[model samples]
Target chain A: MDAVLEADGLGKRYGNRWALRDCTFSLPEGQVAALVGPNGAGKSTLLHLAVGLLRPDDGSVRVLGQQPYDNVAVLPDLGFVAQDTPLYRDFTAAELVTMGGKLNRARWDASVARNRLAQLGIAPHQRVGTLSGGQRAQVALALALSKRPRLLLLDEPVASLDPLARHEFLQALMGSVAETGTTVLLSSHLLSDLERVCDHLVLLETAKVRLTGSVDDLLGTHRQLIGARHDGSAIPGVAAVIRESHTDRQSTLLVRVDGWVDETRWTSTEVGLEDLILGYLGDHRRQGSHAAWGVTA
Target chain B: MVIEFVLDGRSKVNTYMQLVQQVRQALRVGLLESGDQLPKVRDVAQALAINPNTVLKAYRQLEMEGLAEGRPGVGTFVTGTLAGASLMHQAELRADLVGWLRRAQTAGLTADDIVALVDTTIRATLADDVIVVTHT
Candidate 1:
């Protein structure tokens, strides 16, 4: 299956520091995938590369089966909505959506845009700056939807909306994608939203892909085993210890083991998405202990 | 058609799941039954001040679980059954209970304590009158 978006050895640098380094992942067509990372983990950089907004210092990116930079063909089929949701502050919601139609070659239906805006309860004539944060997000979404693109890229699209509006926007976005079979790459800080909407995930930390796979597979492979640490030398095959809670009698460990736990060795338990993220972040912290301790390498 | 929904800000559950669970709870309590039409995704989004996507997700989950169906030209409506199987409904619920039991075990709660908690909670909930808000 051809990926709607693919990154090959993607890296970005600013001066001597790498915002993102050696990152590579691909998003399949017609599926929703999320890029998750802490601040400055290069989620934006990766998103930019995916959308062709920024060229990578190393490697390449393909959007809709073609290179994104200077590629007009991909532009018509892809819609990139940035985190800030850039808009003409002076223009009304309707006016800005109309302007988008004029600026982009992709055919946009004015009535559809109007209906979507009205559905969001955002007045079409209301100035962009005058709308509430949630309403502004709705207008931005309306603009993206109006484009009728086959591939949708959203960065922190629901960051500013209230709980209710966030749900509404995501539902509409999902429905639109479902209806058009649009491949969507959405980045958000909220894991629960992604959990509900996305089947695939890319876990990023330290400017690299820490783990990438379907959510089910990732969860299936990682588990927490509670048992007595009988011997101090080593726990046979546990690759890394995420966390440990112990007493004189029993020791429980959260480990990222490659295989299943033998029931006799320890009681195995499933870990939630949040637990996985905590473990991944803990790994990054341990690996970067030098930076934490302020040692300039 | 007017779409009615209830928002509970107190629950620890994520807002999106809370909304979906509320719709499901409503269904369980007979507030929304088969053939009942849901409000437009946007309307519920706007009225509740949530992102449309979140509501869409709830609706999507509802649709996936067979609680709702989305008709492209018209709108989403309550479905006849949850995914499938009328006879296995109680069995599925029991499986969910077992999953919760495992979680409770992880938390160091005994089976007796779990049963007591459930009984008490069920009794308390049965004591309260249903709160239904109809919006047009």
Candidate 2:
């Protein structure tokens, strides 16, 4: 499969602290991959490295099979919307789209951006700063899509917007993806929102890549078992125990299973993306030891 | 009216599975029938603000199950039904079930308790088919 983004042994540091370390993952093209983790977990750092904002300290990063930073060819194919949705406050929405057209030499469709803003009910003549957070986001997204980039990278674009605005923004985004088949990698703390929009997931924890896989594959392979209290060692066909909790009478275990289990003794139930991601995040917090579980990158 | 699909993202069920089950349930209840057009993938994706690929996957699963078919340049249409009994028979059964449910509610049975009772009874009836044998 052609990967939209790939990283191998990627690491970044600020002063003595490492923001991201040994993060290696590949996202297949045409997938809306979610970059998720708690704060200070390097979600921003990874996205920055991919879009050429920051250079890696240890290993290589590739976007569309080419180095991102300072590469003219790769830069044209990438569109980035930062956390702030940075735009010239004084510029009208129309002027911003015009500026985006002038900036990208490869391909620019001014009407696409203009039409997008119009559809969002954002007046073309209104100053960007005067627009609400959501409208500002739509303008930023319009500018990005105007360039016709093959890959779009977003960093918490909806964190400040209200619920309705968030819905409108995502609806516009999904419509764009449906039309152009653009591969998107968006970093967000909103797990439920991610659950709605992302097909692939990359979970970071304490500056390391903890989990990365398609949402369907991940959910299908992991199971939640509710059974009588006993040592979990005897559970057959288990890959790794992601989380476990118990009472005197019964035990609940979240395990990644490679094959079928005896369903009669233990009620094996499927897990959703949020539960699967939370189980991994919670396990990392409770144990503080990834080594004990033997989770491979 | 077309059957409206709702997905609970927080539930243990996968989103695609939820969609597939909803379509099947709609078919069983006679809300959706053969030749009925399902919503376009993009329309559902935008309406629900979900990933388009998720909608595609669910539609594909439905196609695989022979419950729906997608025609190129056209929309997906329901091609099969889960309705086993005649419509009149099913309607009569549903009416009786509703009456019983009302009586159960008056008897102070919560919705959860009613579901649990029905689920346990169904499982017990199905368990009779499993014949465990021991080798001497």
State fnat for each of the candidate structures. 0.00, 0.74
Please give each candidate's TM-score.
0.69, 0.83
Each model's lDDT? 0.76, 0.89
Where model 1 places Cα greater than 4 Å from the true spot, the runs are A230-250, A256-259, A286-297, B1-136
Clash total of candidate 1: 28
Instruction: After the best TM-score superposition of candidate 2, give how far the Cα of residue A40 lies from its true spot, in angstroms.
Output: 1.0
Number of backbone collisions per candidate, in order?
28, 0
Looking at candidate 1 chain A, the ten consecutive residues that score lowest on lDDT are A229-238
After best superposition, candidate 1 residue A16: deviation in angstroms?
2.9
| Candidate 1 lDDT tens digits, B29-111 | 45677898888765665455444566777889898888889999788999754333454476688789899999999999888
